[model samples]
Target: MEHSHGAHRADDIEDARIKDLTERFRQTLSTKRMNELVSRSVSRASSPAPRDFGTPQPPPSVSDAQLPTYSSLRNIPLVPQAPQDARSLRFKNMLHSLSNMPIRWENPGLLDEALRVVPLEQIYNEAEEESQILQAEAESLGAGKKAAWGYQDCVVRALLRWFKRSFFTWVNNPACSRCYSPTIGVGMAAPLPDEQARGANQVELYKCSVEQCGAYERYPRYNDAFVLLQTRRGRCGEWANCFSMLCRAVGSRVRWVWNAEDHVWTEVYSVHRKRWVHVDACEEAWDKPRLYTEGWGKKLSYCIAFSADGAMDVTRRYVRNVSKHAVERNRAPEAVLLHIMDEIRAMRRSNMSKQDKFRLEGEDMRENRELRSCVISSIAHEVSKLSVEDIMNGRSSRSRADPDTQKALEGRTSGNSEWIRARGEGGRGQPNPQDPRNRQR
Candidate 1:
């Protein structure tokens, strides 16, 4: 009986050893295959130039005269005062034309003209000041000055810079005709997926499609304030916000303007030109000239007819239509939201010293922080697939209590044996008692 029992135990040990060896051999083969696969992928990526998104256009040959002056503005005016009577006259004329015209995207240079009369020097100064303040604030927060401002105050300020620089440019050297076409804005909200929809009224935030692991995220919610096709994703409003936030981080005062129909766009003040100019950052074609019509001929052969004028005309056509309701609102012409944004711009004027801006930012930052926290929290909670804490802590599976939570736990406290042991002891949710990882050390 003793020999029989001993034989059975020996067989069991041999069987277990064989199974273990088989698993080890399989794992070794699998690892080798994975390495080979990775090597092939790397070779392919480095083998040839990546496929271009669109046909590459030849760089525009430039003459000495055509070369742009990269001049920097030294003196920014504190106040931009336009001739009030001239402004009134133009406003009345624009109002009359708007009343008679059909609702269209082109305004025949009405709003464009009024915006031009704005003292460019003053706008430039303010935009610059605001831009500086935002940079400083980012630094104070212990966030890199170039770090993107996801919160409301910094985001809004950043937006102001983008708008001023892009949308407010002089048509002529003397600054007679100005354009304010901001094609898009981007808003950064927490991951608000579809599960938390409130019936038919839920807003969804979408992620960027580009693969380069960027930290930027945008929410494409429609606002009735801008006059564009309200898409749930990839609209001008979201684009403008994205640009604004980025510009602010780098130091600039910008703002977004949407048509009455809620088609959002943007403008930014040029401290050098002392005026507002249009910027269309969302235009995906990076090789194209910054100004419209300059590089369009290469894109479309038929554009030769009136390519330069055609691009301008095409752009103005949209602007005119955006101001369709301006006449109905009277010469008083209160774009209430724009007016508020304008005030923020004014606060950044060159006339105001850096110290003054610091004061304004101090106040703005407090209010902005509160507003942004609320927005981010609300969006995260209301969206429903995730929890607010999960997004805040960069934890996975905030939306569902599942395998993802375990994965997140491992990631958050990797290499901490004490934490793993403690987690195992008192419900998995508890923190490890002796986790040196959690200590500031």
Candidate 2:
């Protein structure tokens, strides 16, 4: 019985060793067996570590599906940005989107149709050329062209071009010639002699149409046509209308006036000279009484009541004396002197400054209107009292007469000695002899 127990224990130990040895052989022969054993042993000891999805995912790598791949945009040439000027910062916003902006027609909903029909480049080029031509023509006419016809032609052409598109839309009636003629006299048209019309004789070219036509007591009547040629003879209103009509007809500008003490007149803009010319045709038609002495010589007065440019009003008495030639030629002291006085009087009325008023008052007092009106009965009284030398020399009179007035009478005389002196010196100076400033200086 003892021998049998020892044999059983030895066999049991031997069997366990055999089982362990068999498991090791199995592991060496196959990976599945090794894994099963490892799994069973780890499970019995501790659970195997589990994989976690909570671990942060790495950033995605570039791939066909994730990346923006380009075949064309990458190859396009980049436009260089323009260097900005500091001073041009104001225009930055205007230019910022210019490159990216698509062309847009100014009229809404027009782009689709305009792009199809209009040649933008051709239209632009043509417009530029036309503007150039207009500029060139305007440049050709500089400041101060003395010729009236030249001024009229240029003004008319400009008007035609400026209003070309509006021509058919509106029309103005052509004015009658007689309605525009300058004459306050009431008389039939008695055409002047061919010689007088042509200004042939040394006699004054301007004579009252009524007088020249030998219309006794009938006087002269103004029509539009006569006013243009004789701007100082028409009725005040007629003269103004005629002058304004002529100027506006050819696209020049003019202003008309009818004040209480004065007759009608116009101020026409002279484009070439950049100044206005006064026109008072009504004043020119009065009869000028002729006066002559064998020794003193023939003295004529051109009775131009007002300057075409609105500078002064020639007195009615003086206007009846001179010939048209005397006026156009700048002859006749009485006419010029009276005109200066008229301007001075106007200045006196318009001056607002007390100092200016006081100065003008002193000048006005010297005219001796009160004393002369009491003493002098006739037109000749004032003129005859003035010595020929005084008239010619523009000599200042102290007998209650203004020296400034005297100087004005001498139209463009040595009183403006500096102008002549400057001319002699050949300086680029032009002193306006008519300017009161030149006289004051």
Candidate 3:
């Protein structure tokens, strides 16, 4: 019985060895086939095409200048380089100061307190309904399809709607409290004791428009997001600040995006999409990066997004067509700008764990890729517009007329016409002399 068992074990071992050899042989054959296929493809590409008549003609030479250049913010590398000039150093300091805006909203206690004013039940109900509709729509399309936006995104959308329509008030100039008359700008004023106590650093002095009731009204600009909760009224600055804090209160990672052209917005990190989405609380716009450029006909120089964890130059996302929408980025040298970003990122991540740092680094790499793709897509769109005849004749395609002029003519929906025109955001119109872009900040 022992001899029989030994013979069976030997047979089983031999069978296993044979199976292993067969698998190895199969893999070797597959690799050889793949190598042969690759070699053939390479040879075909390198070799001249088969002669149709006599000899194969060499390909026509194309000048480097003829090649389309897709300009984008990706051209700026993240290599750290110190500012060499005074101007660049000043720019860096200014950006560092602005970067502190997001950190102010990081108070967990304050964020919790801010949530007390929000109608959570109503917001959640709206978000749930929207998310369900989106899910159903996705499923209706087919299997393996995903919803347009996640539940969290729906929640933000609901918040945006509520904040814009019902909660926040847009004040061009505050109306007179006693007489309810409109007020005209009378210039800057000192913050009163009560205003200073609530974090108002600057106050605007305005006189009642009515000559009879020329009472001076004080409009304190509160920098604190928590204070903004109680007031709930101002321009884009107040809107973005308060709404971004509210978004954080509801568990969304937020960024305070500052535009050099005197506009501010919010960016909410979409965990589901693994990307930061643009949200303009003033316009109630979600994920529309081009709203300022294409929608309002404004040329953007800088759009920096500052989050608690880091900062990013998101100009490429907003200015896809550099020739059309981008202004000169002369604030700092590209290298110095990169260094500033790295410094801010390092400072913010200083206290973070190794795992968290690794995760953020990965996210940064992904975002860089996304920004690069934006440039590529824009180039592709431009190339698609070029006809074969135009390319062959070495003439460029005629520029397409602005098709969205009518839409742009709607102007900035958030502010009054005078204010919009003053800011040069009045769609297709002559340049405003008082455009903030023309002035030094």
Q: What is the TM-score of each candidate against the true structure?
A: 0.22, 0.20, 0.79
* Each model's total of backbone clashes: 72, 49, 0
- Model 2's lDDT to the true fold? 0.34
Q: lDDT tens digits, residues 1-441, model 1?
A: 999999999999999987866665555444544444444445546554234322222223323454334332111211222224555456434323322211221233433432343344555555466666766776888854452222233333433444445542211011111222211223334334442241112233333333343223333233221221122123344454444333433334443433322222344434433323354444421112112222111011110001000101112212111222011333332332223233334533447778876764554455345435534654454456666887899876544432212321221221134433542322223332332211110
Indicate the residue-level lDDT of 107 in model 2.
24
Off by over 4 Å in 3: 1-78, 391-410, 428-441
Per-model lDDT: 0.35, 0.34, 0.81
Ranking by TM-score: 3, 1, 2
How displaced is residue 302 in candidate 2, in Å? 2.3
Give the C-alpha lDDT of model 1: 0.35
Q: Pick the lDDT winner.
A: 3
Question: Superposing every Cα of model 1 onto the true structure, what RMSD results?
Answer: 29.0
